[model samples]
Target: MRTPRTAAVLVPLMLLALGCAPQNSSTATDTSASSGANQTPADCAQGKTMKDGVLTVGTDSPAYDPWFSHNDPTNGKGFESAVAYAVAKQLGFDHSQVTWTKVPFNTSYAPGPKHFDFDINQISITPARAKVVDFSDGYYNAAQAVIAVQGSPAADASSLADLKQYKIGAQTGTTSLTAIRDEIQPTSDAVVFKNTNDAKTALANGQVDAIVTDLPTAFYLAAVEIQHGTIVGQFQPSAGQQEQFGMLFEKGNPLVACVNRGLAALKSSGQLAAIEKKWLSDTVDVPVLQ
Candidate 1:
């Protein structure tokens, strides 16, 4: 997940991608509670704060490309980056009124209170994580897949049974690698990496046959940084396997309602679809978020 260093290449591609009409379909899951007669308060609170009035969001400092272009989360250039601002705008907050903070991925959803109004770092909503923090309706629904160098054994493995003999790598403590272990259970061995970059490098050096990551990250590596690679195929979600990215908020926080409202607005207005086409497709042909 590297940042895009050249705006010249990225900006035009972004415009071209957004020029088309979005496909018709709802992308967000329903997470709203039944409402009473008073809908004014709810309508006016799209992305607003309780008292401070400033929308504070948290993301990784060095956010990656196609998610946050060139580490500028405020610019709304990347898919999630633009979605964050879109959510803010729906909540009645201007871009200037919104603030950004850096939060490490590993501890962002830990079992405890949070310090930001909401966090948008492409975090997947899982049941285990739901025990600690509440997630807004999914802003993006993604799939997991394998990334392999061209002509490798994995390049031909289209199904779970086909991938059992390859050595794979996945970031530590992630479902991507877990899928490789519990599902594929490669015949050779599954290597572990601290991040996607490490896994990519390992693939380059022949340390592993393939690396399992979210479809978006796989697309990024295949299309942008690692021209030698390609995404094998997306994995089908098992009973506990589907992955959805959501706005992370503190457990029981009032901001969850506002975040969900903003997401619905963005999706309904086709803004989310625009962001998706711009960043995700240009980065990789495989649809990362739908």
Candidate 2:
């Protein structure tokens, strides 16, 4: 995903998008247990870190945007980058005390020891994932968007029922795939791709009517990746719940409580919202399909 260089246009649009409240009823699935109970963020983070005084973070390589910028995680310019630093600040680690390491997205949450204090790579909070690793409270609520080649039938859909006739596609194991089966419930079995690129290619080749992915990634595919791709619309993947992204941690790591404190403070103080506005503002324009 390409980061929008100009904040001039996207900021107001982002404000408008943020104004609409989510209709979903379910709360985020993962939250740190006893989040910093009886301890300050700094104290909760002490001695629990991979290093005594440094806050080590992990994210996948070639980090995409608008989550990361120019494939760099240390610049603190992208949404996740800025958020990670904000959390570190809340936990008392300054810029010079922080370090980043490469951790593949899947490996970051796998059942095993971890090499970083925390990992943030847009990993969603889910019951299954939470069983293996602890997660800070959700920092971003995500929506699924449909994308199709411009002028395709799927591009014309105005409602979920209108999409019932199409052969929808999504990457296997993603919430987008779950949306296809559980939300859209298309007439035919969905065309599951191995990854997002495969789904994008399928849409470009007219092998599938449409592809679904999180709204930000959908915007990226339509605006940057696929020359002819256009977003059809957006929707909450779960009918009554909004999907959310969380920072992952090793299970039983007390530092999760501290990170959650940072997220909580950022949310209440409006810094988190501001960071999201700066990076994800382009996502506001597409019509939302219910």
Candidate 3:
């Protein structure tokens, strides 16, 4: 049964999800030219960037593990960090010619002028957000996973149906929360936390039966953060829609095209896949919870 506390959490989550849900309108910027086969490095580097003679990149502060190593996006060690440098290389910028800045996750997509040439903090490409910001071609495809205490009922859940009655939690404003409300649709409203660390704490304290996060982060959390954490399973995006991470830019910025071109080159050369294998290889083999 749903408790008063859970009910309080659900009301806001449902409203936020409804407010941010992707719209069907054709407002997202077109990327056909940027992703075309004939795009060249010189063409991609033609646009004015945030900094002269340098590629200014933005990511969240204290970047987490598996994404940015040791909270340093400048080291070019983690997956996103490495991909950033690779994309810069394809855009004709050398390793030392790129610069890093800190941009919070929520502010990266908000409507406004941006401070970076491109921001890459695993910001998912969504029509709703694209209305306010330009997104380059998808750089990574992602899936959501459920994490629970090792001996809990949620840990034993083999399918979506098996998880519907348990108390679930996820970071507010993330696709993980949307998945809980729209895909899992549990009997009670899922708790929303300020961040992944908060959700992890809730799961550890038994405040929630389980928490949802992206597959790679789930693997990391289950194996390192939470002593008894175990991933129950993973699920594809709801309604056959693929959730993809993209680089973000200011609305109508010409830089989007250039970044898209660089991303295309990375994808064509298999560098993206290689980087994924290096950092997120543990994300494989989790059973699909239908």
lDDT scores of the candidates, listed in order: 0.65, 0.73, 0.73
Which model is ahead, 1 or 3, in terms of TM-score?
A: 3
Model 1 spans > 4 angstroms off? 1-51, 239-242, 281-290
C-alpha RMSD in Å of predicted model 2 compared with the true structure: 4.5
Best by TM-score: 3
Clashes of 1: 3
Q: Over all chains combined, what TM-score does candidate 2 have?
A: 0.82
Q: Compared with the true structure, what per-residue lDDT tens digits does model 2 show for residues 1-290? A: 22343321122211110101132212232334555467767777777788878999998776766778888999998888999999999899999899999986547668889998888886767766677887777677677778888887888999988999999998765667777888889999999876677788888888999988777777667877777888888787544555667777888787766777777778778898888877876425678787
Determine which window of 10 residues in candidate 1 has minimal summed lDDT. 15-24
Clashes of each: 3, 2, 0
Distance (Å) between predicted and true CA of 38, model 1?
4.5
Kindly report which residue pairs in candidate 1 clash with one another: 46-91, 47-91, 164-187
Candidate 3 versus the native: TM-score? 0.85
Ranking by TM-score: 3, 2, 1
**Residue pairs in collision within model 3:** none
> How does residue 54 of candidate 2 score in lDDT?
91
- Candidate 2 lDDT score relative to the true structure: 0.73
Error of 3 at 22 (Å): 9.1
Weakest 10 consecutive residues of candidate 3 by summed lDDT = 10-19
Error of 1 at 78 (Å): 0.7
